[model samples]
Target: MHRRASPGSQDHFDLFPYIAILMSLLGALLTATLGMASLSLGPGVAETWDMAARDGTASKAPVLVEWDGSALTVHEGAQRRRVPWLDDQAAAAGGMRPRSAAMQRLLAEFGQRSATGYVLFAVRPSGFATLPRLTDDFRAAHIDIGYEPVGQERGVQLLSAGEHP
Candidate 1:
């Protein structure tokens, strides 16, 4: 026979098991959240890189320069100076000589570093059509250079030797 409770009596139930299950679920979610947070991707995760020499000689730090369709902006650490675009007259010269004074001086400066360093051009989309011409001009002027395509408005930061990021 089963005993029945009186109408005035109260029945209490334990909630500890349910509470424990919820707590464990919360712990698992928190752990997953933290695990996902630690995994980073893209440019943000690209912090440091050790540059290797191309020719088995001592690797020279690259000179960072931005190329839009109009001009080349050289990045020397925190400093930046724009190298004016080739003028119509220089273009007409068939790469023999630059008519612009600024272009002449910049070329002269880069000419001396051909063997010691290389120019890394961050070419913008607008500069794509003129990239070959720009590279040709630099080559004609005896400047060693390589290029990488980048977004139009993106800014590039160059890391120095023995530096990170």
Candidate 2:
């Protein structure tokens, strides 16, 4: 049937209300998503981002920091060596030093071996708690450190040069 819309009469049902309702629902959903995103960006998050941004130097080798349930270790290239911590019972009670003697030795070794000035540090789950101080220590030695978190299954992830931190 060909029914024309008259001057003061309707030929079909008005869909404006339906469109308005859909728009309202979409607006509500958008509002919720934005609110959640804002909540996630806490004060600490911004500070951490700023800190990461400060280390803007391009990195080289990917070094993973690992903890084998007993000791802290480092995996660089194919070498997985134990980083012997000092006898500081209180710092970690678990006997893990944030800045270890073996680490200093490793730094010397890197100085002799690698030609690159930066190294990205990937931390194992067990070693994450000890990472902050260790990263700071590496920075103190003029080595750039970028964060890379290895999964539970992968003990150490050695990212290649083409890959990232």
Best by TM-score: 1
Cα RMSD, each candidate: 8.1, 11.1
Where is model 2 poorest over a 10-residue stretch in terms of lDDT? Answer: 45-54
Choose the strongest candidate by lDDT.
1
lDDT of 2: 0.59
Query: Candidate 2, which segments miss by more than 4 Å at Cα?
Result: 1-59, 67-71, 88-98, 111-117, 159-165
Q: lDDT of each model, Cα atoms only?
A: 0.77, 0.59
lDDT of candidate 2 over 1-165, digit per residue (tens):
998877788466899999999999999999999999988864434111111233556444445555533355676567877766444554668654554566678767655544554555555676677677666666666665577666545544555444454
